[model samples]
Target: MTDARVMRDRQASVASAARRLDDASGQHSGAALVQTKAVGAYPAAASAYYACTPLRIDGPETEGAAVTFTGDPSRIIMALNLGSRIPPVGTRLIIHSSGGRWAFRYDG
Candidate 1:
C-alpha cells in the first residue's frame, strides 16, 4: 500500500511539472510586435517571398540590429522570434530569427 501511494505521488508530481512546462512554452511562443512597409503592386502570393536583411534600429542611447525586409515602407507587419506566431494582416513588424528569412500568416 505504501509503495503504491509513493508511485501515485510521483506520477502526480511529474504531471504537474509537465503542465507547468507546457504553459511556459506556450507563453514564450507568440508574436512580440508589428511592423509595416510598402511594396510594388505584386500578387499576394509574392508577399511571402520578401527578402530580409540585417539593419539597425537607432535610438538615442542604444542601437539594436534586426532583420528587415526590402520593399515598400508602407505595408504593416510585425517582428517575431523563432517559435513565435506571425501577426495578423494589417499589423506590421520586423521579425528576427536565426533561421533564414521567411514570412508567416495567422491561419485563424
Candidate 2:
C-alpha cells in the first residue's frame, strides 16, 4: 500500500509539473523579422532595426530600439539588433511572447 501511494504521489507531481510547463508555454509565441515596413501607424509600425551586430532585444533597454508591437501571433512584434543593417525579409528572429510582452533574438 505504501509503495502504491508513493507511486501515485510521484505521478501526481509529474503531472502537475507537465501541466505547469504547458500552461506557461501557451502564453508565448515566436516569429521572425521578415520585413520592417513603414506602416501608416507611425510609431506603431515596425522598422528594420539594429542592435549589437548579433543583436538581442529582450530587456527594458529594447524600448529604444526600432520595432513595434501589433498584438499577438502572426504580427506580434518585429525588431532587430541596433547595429545590424536591416536584414532582408524572412530573417529568422527568435521571438518570445509572455504576458503580451515580446523579446527578440537573432539565432544567426
Candidate 3:
C-alpha cells in the first residue's frame, strides 16, 4: 500500500490503540500522525516518524521511495520516507524528548 494509505490506516488504528492504552494504563495518551505541516514539506520526515510513533496524519508529502523507523520512543523519532525504499528490520532511531503532550505516528 502507498504511504499515504498506510498513514490513513494508522490514523484509524490509533484511535483504537489509544483506547486500549488508556484502558490498560488508566491515563489518556492521545495518538496522532505527525504531518508535513508540523514537520516540513517532505513526507520523508513524516513517514520516518510514522514508522516510529502512532500520530494521526492530515496531509500528503513528496512521493517517490520511502523509509520507516519504528520502536519504543521515549523521545522524538525522525526518518526520511522517500521513494519505495524501506528501512531494514531492527534499525535504530533517534528521538528527542520534551515535556509536552505525548504523540505517536506509525505506518505499518
Candidate 4:
C-alpha cells in the first residue's frame, strides 16, 4: 500500500537525521577531549606562602622595596620597590605591579 511505503520512507529519513546528529555529537566530544589534553600538558606555577608580618621600606618612587614573606623569604617578596606607594605593611595586597602576584601583611 502507498501509505505503508510513505511511512517507511519517513522512518528512513528520521533514522538518517538521528545518525547525523549522533555523528556531530561524537565529533564535539572528541574536540573537547583534545582541548582538555592540551591544557593538561602545561606546567602549573608553584604557590608561595604569605608572611604574617610584612616589612616596610623606604626608597625611590619608581621601584618599591621587596618585602619577603615570613615562611619563604627567597621565594615570596613584595616586588614593589621601597618608595612605591603601596598599602600599609600589614595590609593584604594582590600585587598587580609586577606579574599577577598576591601577598598579605600590615606591619612588621
Candidate 5:
C-alpha cells in the first residue's frame, strides 16, 4: 500500500510539472523595432500590419514583442521603438509570431 501511495504522489507531481511546462512553453517572449504604415484605423486596430523588416528584436519588453519573437521577424509586424506611441513618435507596429495569435496593450 505504501508503494502504491508513493507512486501516485510521484505521478501527481509529474503531472503538475508537465502542466507548468506546457503553459510556459506556449508563452511568447521578445521584442523588436519595426517600421509600420498607417493601415485602417489609427491605433485601435490590431493585427492589421505587414512588412516587419529592418527589425531589431531583443529580450523581453512588452506583450507586443513577446508574441512576435519566434527567432524570425518575418511574417510579423513590429511597433516603432522610438518617440511616443502616437504619430509624433510615429505609430509603432506591434510585432507578433506566425498567424498573428498575439495581442498588445493600447498604445499612447
Candidate 6:
C-alpha cells in the first residue's frame, strides 16, 4: 500500500492534470488560428490582428488541413476565407501565447 503522503501527492497531481486538460480543451480553446485582414494598397502591409468568427470547427487541425497552416501560401490564403480582397500572399501574423508571455511575428 502507498503511504498517506504519496496518496495525497498522487491525488493532487491528478487533479492538476485534469484542470489543465479542461482548460486547454474548453469551449473557447487555448490556441487560436487567426486570419489578418487587408489594410489597403498603401504601405503594402496589413496588421496581424482582426479576429474572425470561429467556423465551428470541431475536429483536430489535421482533420481540417484546409484551414490550418500547411506551409503553403495558397492553402493558408484559401483557408482564411477572408474574401478575395486579401493579399495574394500571406500577411504578418504575431502570435501571443501564455498570457502575452511570448509573442513573435511571422511574415512568411
The most accurate candidate by lDDT is 5
Residue 64 local lDDT, model 6: 36
Per-residue lDDT for 16-107 in model 3, tens only? 65443431113443332332223333243333433343332224466754544332233333434432443343333222222322323234
* TM-score head-to-head 3 vs 5, winner: 5
Which is the better candidate, 4 or 6, if ranked by lDDT? 6
Cα misplacement distance, residue 53 of candidate 2 (Å): 30
lDDT value, residue 81 of candidate 5: 30
lDDT, candidate 6, at 98: 42
CA deviation > 4 Å runs, candidate 4: 23-108
Q: Which window of 10 residues has the lowest lDDT sum in candidate 4?
A: 30-39
Error of 3 at 35 (Å): 42
Tens-digit per-residue lDDT, 1-108, candidate 5:
699999999899877654433211245344334444444444533433333333344567766555433233233344423332343223344543332323233345
TM-score of 1: 0.25
> Please, what is the TM-score per model?
0.25, 0.26, 0.21, 0.22, 0.25, 0.26
Worst 10 residues of 2 by lDDT: 45-54
Report the Cα RMSD per candidate.
12.7, 14.5, 17.3, 22.3, 11.9, 12.4
Candidate 5 TM-score, true structure as reference:
0.25
Error of 1 at 93 (Å): 4.5
- Which has the higher TM-score value, candidate number 3 or candidate number 4? 4
lDDT of 2 at 88: 42
The lDDT of each candidate is: 0.37, 0.39, 0.37, 0.31, 0.41, 0.36
TM-score of model 2 vs. true structure: 0.26
- Top TM-score: which candidate number? 6
For model 6, residues 2-68, the per-residue Cα lDDT tens digits are 6998999989987765554322114434444434433343223333333222122343667435544
**Candidate 1, 7: how far from true, in Å?**
53
Cα lDDT tens digits, model 2, 1-108, are 699999999899877654433211254234332333333332321333422111223434554676543322333243434332444443444444333334454333
